[model samples]
Target: MSPQWFVVYCKSREESRAQRNLENQGVYSFFPKIHKERILRGKKKVVEEALFPSYLFVNISQKDEKFSAIRSTRGINSFVKFGMSIATIPDQQVKQLEQLCHVNNKLAINSDDAYKNGDKVEILSGPFKGITAIFDIEDGLERSMLLLKILNQDNNISFKNSALKKAES
Candidate 1:
């Protein structure tokens, strides 16, 4: 009857609400969120959004847990299932996700492997604000370079990862 992590499929846009309800019921849950940079109303803004929309992790011991109460909880759809059996997540996976949540929450820029050289990007802040440039990541850290066009000539410039944002197609 040891506690194991399970995936909960929550109602649309109700991941936070569902997590609260589960916690109130004494069920341990993990809801990872990330800061997302988005253009809102023609201005740049950073918003906290769920890392996985409509999904959350719950740690529960099936033998000692109240399945009926959890199933009927408001804002929760049901547990993720495969056929007739509910899926159980490994503890190591949960711990890794927890670590990632902590690390990613502190980062202003996404650490995902989506950036590559020659990719179009825009500077979100600093002297290069509003200027589009080509992405050039070096050493996979904060220090990176950018290629900007000046007078029809490509100019290479160094910039921090936080100062860049992906350009819209």
Candidate 2:
């Protein structure tokens, strides 16, 4: 059988380590990452973060590769599976992800692609953490305006773009 792409679940915050160990064992892996601009101690910094936290892709041929070796690799928790079947990622999807990461791994801080007006967003930090709000507009390069409801009243508030994330639907 030919090699197929499969998802590997790794220890928390150890996707890179898992990838390295897999590569050392001659097992090909892909750990997708994105460059994000973050504000740290009042300074803007660019940091690389795993696109899929705690998860990475591996290429393995069941007919040729030892599954036990992969499972025993450091930093790897297990192969992502459902019941008795191991999940596999379609080759085309993996190719698309590779292309996207290669072409634009750095997230644009001011790009409108990050959010759109009236989109629901969640406060990721600060006093508003755990609160859901409606995205209003980008106040500037680093700040955004959101419609937050408090005491049944919709109030306009501004927060750093890094502090908000699109709320899961």
Candidate 3:
């Protein structure tokens, strides 16, 4: 039987391990990761962290009660869904996300990020890498100042001498 892709719940910040768990159990899973350079205690470090938190996609047969066994494992919740039905993940959305990751170098949300005049602007690495930032500057592309919001808090992510572009409006 062809495996259908389903969303699996994971422990907060445990997405990488959760993917490994499913793989060890002979389940095909997708948990995209990004390698980034981080600073820890005034030291620079390279780390691999899950692109998505508390969620991973699994390719498995939608068998009766099989998910029960899956849900019992560590760092899992349940599939994302609507009332009385599990929401079907769109193939296009997945494709677009992958493309966005490659094009710019970061994950952009499925929200309207199209910016306007005087909007805070910051260039990430490539296209759409501005924390989904949007703005217009005289020399935006030459020097970009991005505000990186980490840990659910607003913080400045300034990137100078970057190639900046107007956020899609």
Score every model by TM-score.
0.64, 0.64, 0.52
Candidate 3 stretches greater than 4 Å from native: 64-66, 91-169
lDDT tens per residue, model 3, 31-111: 766656566765444566667767787767667345557777667777877787765566667667667556543433222
lDDT of 1 at 58: 88
Error of 2 at 35 (Å): 0.7
| RMSD over all Cα atoms, model 1 | 9.9
Candidate 3 weakest ten by summed lDDT: 134-143
Candidate of highest TM-score: 1
Give a tens-digit lDDT track for model 2, residues 72-154.
89999999999999999999999999988876764443365578889999999999999999999777568999999999999
Which predicted model would earn the best lDDT?
2
Rank order (by lDDT, best first):
2, 1, 3
Counted clashes in each candidate structure: 0, 0, 4
lDDT of each: 0.83, 0.87, 0.61
Q: Is candidate 1 or 2 superior in TM-score? A: 1
User: Which pairs, if any, clash in model 1?
Assistant: none
